[model samples]
Target: MTVILLAGGLGSRMYPLTRIVPKPMVPLAGKPILEHIVDYLNTRGFKEIVIAARYLGEQIVRYFSNHPHAKPVLLDSKDTADAVRLLGNYIRDHFIVAMGDVICNADYSEIYGYHLSANPAATIALKQVENPLPYGVVYLDENMDVALFVEKPVSLEAYLLSLAYYRRRSTSAYENLVNAGIYVFNPYVLEVLERNPGLMDFGRHVFPYLVENGFKVKGYVLSHRVYWSDIGRIDTYKSVMWDLLDGKIAGIKPPATEVSPGVYIHPSSDVRGEIRPPVYIGREVRVKEGAVVGPYAVLEDGVVVEEGSRMVESIVWHGTIVGRDSVIYDSIVMNNVKISRETRVYSSIIGTRRIVSGELRNSIMEPVEVVSPYAQSA
Candidate 1:
């Protein structure tokens, strides 16, 4: 079956990082998030894949140019439904749709089988979250049919009112099942799209329309053990990285060799410093003497950590250099950045290809030619 991977959003939430590359292009483990998704889909036996991308989409095109089955389609639309509507010709029959930013190890084969068995107009994959306010909350009946859908309840009163409506009908309301941003739809859904020309989003528009118009919409609730995260923000991105290192995610593994219990280092890497567990040192990395790296650190390919430096709970992308005596705590230093001597980075995100020469705390350093605003004496 053909799967449409929607990846066209501008990703304004990720800011400078998304400015450099699309959200799907964001590196995770040792490859882009999109690559992981594609590889997983390939393993699941998906033959044809179309990637809908814009806003630095050429990078995605270039990356997948030689691929046999996966192809990139550049579109100018900003909305999810619109992207699919533009590719309506590609939808020959029943198809699967997934968001590009989400990282999920869901069983697509099982979801497809469930969809075919239920015979609904559309089937939505749902996952329970502790806090449903940030996501599109879904209310399902006893038969696993969607009763109501609310896209990111704006206020507590609104959420409570929706919960109340669900509580009156079924006790399932207690389970906070939110939209997982993956769906299987029948071909007639294309007719619905054509009927509503202005429909732009699936959560805010399409799903609700399908439920209210008496079309059968099924809900496939994932098990509690399943892992799913839309890495839309900085903290979630960092947390997902930690989860990958901890082996919390199934069907995905770090692209490195395990030297010790939880320490993964590439064969070409040179390490003279001390390394704690749960760390990943990538290709050609160099950790100079007296440096301490670990306990949730991912130093990507070609990264150099100088002597006396310490990095904890941080991710330094490919080709970045950490100067001597520097400290990186709970931060993400993007690709090719240069951290000067004795610098301190705490809970911040340093953008790509920049020179950091100061102390940054709880801030986001944009990708600009000028040095960081917090520059100070080492």
Candidate 2:
């Protein structure tokens, strides 16, 4: 089956991070988020992948163009409608479509199988959310078919109550299922997309056209409760990390968290720590320590923990150094950051190649330190 990934947005919500990088290029765990999706698709036995791109689309082009399994389509068009129209020209058959920003936990195989068998003009993946007001909500029929779609509503209680009612389909007044940004569709859906070029939304535009025209659009309830999140803001980004740290999501077996008895290390890393499973080291990374590493901390690759430094709940990036007796707590240190001895850094993000050789600093990167947080602090 052909899987289409929409990677066109400018990702305005993911500022600071997205300022220098595209959303999909933003790193998660250790690698870029886009790479993870590709791996997910490959694992589910899907080979043909297409990415729709814009806004520094070259990054997307540059990435997949080099990869073996990635087949990309660059769309330097206006809004969502034009992008979809462009894709329709190529995806003339049934295909799977997903948003580049929506990170998911469920496998594509089951979703694809259901779409094939159901033979609906479109199959919409549904997930019940506690807060549905911020997103598009699709109302389903008793037969688990889509009846109507709603964009973000201004009314709050009506929205929440709608979701509450929709969640319990058997006794509810209506069946409300928020789209999980996953869709499966036949070529006919593409025709709708092309004709309604002015309607720039799938939920607000094409799907409603299906309903108004009496097309068979089915809604499949997602069975697995997986870790699904959109990494668009700093808070959401923090939430993703916290979720990974807590092992809340199943499908994403984070690297291999084997922090020794008193250690806390990430799974994909190698560490020689004083304490034994509580240590968190990131992918292809290493840590050598007479240093007290982590009861809880993350070290990205090429990070060095020099002798006798203390760190907890802190994140250090590739090539950063934690100098001897340098105490870092609840902070993020970027790549190539060098901390001189006996300095104390807490609750801060130090930029890359920044030199810190002072007494104590709170949430501040050194100025002549030559490290700018935008570039230095990855």
Candidate 3:
């Protein structure tokens, strides 16, 4: 079975960090997010995989070459559906489609088997999240078929009123079952996509069209043990990082060796500081004497923590240097950043390769490319 991974989005929400790197290339647990997905798919017995990428897709292509199991399809268009539509010829009868930015613990083998047995035109993986306003809520009938799809209503009250007016009012009970950005679809669904050239997203267009046209679209509720999250926003990214360190997220292991109880230090690093548990120090990292790191800190490869500095609940990226007497707490420092001595950084997202010398708290510091007002829109 072929797996289609959509990685073509601009990822404006994760800007500055994603200004030079694509969303899939964003690091999670010391590896690219897409690498974990590929590892997950490989373990599930799915061999052939194709990635549809645009908007700095070259980084992805360069990172993973044309291997037998993994192939890259650099698209001219940025639309998700268009990327999938371009690969329609490669898909034989059925295919697995997933968003690149999402990380989930759903069992692909079981989901694929369920789809094959039910023989539906499309099968969407659904998960019940606390907040349904930000997602497209799916209403499943008694037979587990998709009865209706609501694409993120402006207000929850409006959605409830519309739901109360529907013929199958009881379907509101399943309002929390939002789309998980994962799907198993037959060639017929792709045919439906081909008919509408402007259709761009599965939740916004394809899934709704399938239900409206009387096509059978089923929903598969994931098991409770499964974990799912979208690392699109800065807060979510930081949360996911801490989750990984705390062992809250399964199947994502940091590449560092556990030196002490919860302290993981890479073999190539030079450390002489005090490192608390639940810390991950990557390769070639330098921790000078009198520096205190840890209790949820991650220093990626080539990072330098100078003397008398303290870091806690922070993620410092590759090649970044923290000077003497500096303190960082509850923050995310992007790649190649340099912090001068006596600086204090907390609760912020510092962009790639920036130089910081002052005390910044409860603020966002993005790179030059993401500082302009038009950067978010672009």
For model 2, residues 270-362, the per-residue Cα lDDT tens digits are 666464234457655655667776655767666777777788777676667777877888776766778898888877766656788776555
Candidate 3 lDDT by residue in tens digits, 101-193: 888878888899999999999999999887766776788888899888877677788876665555256443455787888899987877787
Candidate 2 scores a C-alpha RMSD against the true structure in Å of 4.6
Q: Per-residue alpha-carbon lDDT of model 1 for 264-333, expressed as tens digits?
A: 8999999999999789898889999999998899998889999999999999887899999999999988
Q: In model 1, which regions exceed 4 Å deviation?
A: 171-174, 369-378
Measured with C-alpha atoms, the lDDT of residue 102 in candidate 1 is 91
What is the TM-score ranking, best to worst?
Answer: 1, 3, 2
Using alpha carbons, what is the TM-score of model 3?
Answer: 0.92
Using lDDT, give the best candidate's number: 1
Model 2's TM-score against the true structure: 0.80
Which candidate has the highest TM-score of all?
Answer: 1
lDDT of 2 at 185: 87
Which ten residues in a row are the worst by lDDT in model 2? 369-378
lDDT of 1: 0.86
Off by over 4 Å in 2: 154-176, 245-248, 254-270, 275-280, 283-286, 334-378
